[model samples]
Target: DNFLGTLGGPGITVPVVGAAFEVGIELAAGGVEVNLVVDASSEFRTTSNVIANSPAGRDDRVVVVGAHLDSVAEGPGIQDNGSGSAAILEIAIQMANQQISPRNQVRFAWWGAEEAGLLGAQHYVDQLSPRDIKDIALNLNFDMIGSPNFVRFVYDGDGSDTPLAGPNGSKNIESVFLDYFAAMSLPVEPTAFDGRSDYGPFIEVGIPAGGLFTGAEGIKTPDEAALYGGTAGDQYDPCYHLACDTFDNISLQALDEMSDAVAHSVMTFAMTTSAVNGTDKGKGLGKFKSDMEYRGSHLVK
Candidate 1:
C-alpha cells in the first residue's frame, strides 16, 4: 500500500549479513553510525547481524528498536517476523527520510535465532559491558505483526495489571502504544512478556522493554474476538509456525496502521528519550530546547 510505504516504507528483502552490510554503508553516510556485534558462541554460529544507529543527541544512551532477521524452521516467517523486521526497517528508512533526530541514540537491531530460545538477543546483551547496558534507556521489540486474525498486544514486562507494567519491577515499555492508539482512537490490548520474544533479554536485566504482536501459538478468547471481530476459540493466528504463514496471511490494514504506530513510537521515543531519562540537557538538549522554544514562540506570535 502507498500509505505503508509512506508511513513505514516498502518491505525489503532481509537476507542474513551480506545484505546487512550493503545497507549499513548507506546508514553510515547518512550521519548514522552502524556496527555489528557478533557472538561467536551463539547457537546460530552466524554473525551477519546488523546494528544501525542514529544519535538523537550526543549521549551514549540508546533506545533500541529491534526485530529478529532469522526465521523459524517452520516457514519463511513472513508474518512471524517478516512483518516485524520490515516494520522496523521502514521505521529506520522513515527516520532517515524525515531527518528527525531525537535526544538519545536509536539503534535498529536485526537479531538471529530468536526462535531458538532468544539466543541472539541474549548473546548481544551478554556481550554488553555492565556500563554499556546501563547506558541503555529502553528496548522496543517487534515480532509477529502481520497476522490477519489477531489481536494487537503490547508487552507488560512488570505485570502490574496495568498495560504499562509487568510482574517484575520492569515497566511496561509498551505503553507508548496506548499513546499512539489514543491519538488515533485505535483499540489497544495488553499482553504479558512471558519470556516469549527477544525482549526477554532486556526484561531479565530490569531495562524496560515492550513491543507489539498480532498473535501466535495461543488461541483467541471470546472476549478478544468480541473486541477485535475475529472468531473466538480459534488460534489467535492460525498460520503461526507453519509454512502457510506467508505475506497473504497478513492484513494490509493492520500492517499499514501498525507500521505507523511503530514509526511514531520510535520517533517519539528517540526525541523524548532524554527527557524521560532526565538527560535531555546533555548536548542535544540545547538544540532541542532552542527548537522547541522557537516553535513555541511561533505559536504564540
Candidate 2:
C-alpha cells in the first residue's frame, strides 16, 4: 500500500511531505536507486471574487495597485501577505478620506489564490480587451513587506542586476521607490524581477510593474544586518509559510515604513504618470536607472 498526500494543484512542484527514513535507507546503500511515484489525480476549480474599488474620471489611464489576500493552509499569513493587504486597504481608505483626485485612475485590488499561483491576476489580465489593456498605465505589487528580520528590498525593474526586467517604464517605476528611499535616507537594496509574485501577470503583458518586499525565505547576511539592523545568519522570516506566521510574525517598524512608502508611490503616480509611462500620452518610456548598486557587496561573507 502507498501513502497518498494531497498536493496544492498545478504549479506546485515541491513535495508537501516525504519519508526521510526511507530516503536515508536508500542513501545508505551506495548502489541503491529510488523511483518515486506521484498520483496527482484531482479536480481543479476556478473561483472568483468581488473586486471592490473606487474609480477615477481618467479611466483611460489606470494605475493598478494589488496585493494577495489569501494565506497558506498552515497559518494566518499575517506577514507573508496580510501585511501587504492591510497596508493597501488603509491607503485606499485614506485616499477616500482625503478626497484626493488624480490624473490617472487608481484601482486597488485584493487578489485571491495568489498562493496557489498568480491565478487571480492572470484571470484579470486575460479578461481585458486590447484597448482596455492599453489603458493600464502601470502596476504596483506589494508582498511580504513586514518580515520579522526585514530589509528594504525594491524590485530591480531595469534588469541591471536580475535576469527578469519589466516592460518599458518599469525602470522609472523602480526609480520612484529608489528616489523616495534616498530622500528619506533609508537604506534600500534591489530584489530580482523573477516574477515570483502577483506582478508576474501584469509584466507578462508588457505592463510596467514595480513594488516592494521586506524579505522572505532568504537568509539575512552580516552585511544586510549592518545596513538594516537585524540579526545576521537568520532567515528574513523564520515563520514563512508556517503556522507560526501569526500576527506576531510581523515587524511593526517594517510595516509602518513600507505603508508610508506605498502611500507615497500611489499619490505620486496618481498625480502624474509622466515619470512612469511618459509625458507624451504614454508614447515614451523612462530609461533612467537609479544609481545604487551594492549587489555582491551586501552578501554574507
Q: What is the TM-score of each candidate against the true structure?
A: 0.73, 0.82
What RMSD does each model have against the real structure? Answer: 15.9, 7.4
Best by TM-score: 2
Q: Write the per-residue lDDT of candidate 1 for residues 237-263, one digit (tens) a residue.
A: 688777888888787777787787787
Give per-residue CA lDDT, model 2, range 61-86, as digits (tens).
78899999888777789998999999
- Model 2: CA > 4 A from native: 1-41, 273-275, 279-301
Question: lDDT: which candidate is best?
Answer: 2
List the global CA lDDT of all models: 0.68, 0.80
lDDT score for candidate 1 against the true structure: 0.68
Where does candidate 2 clash, by residue pair? none
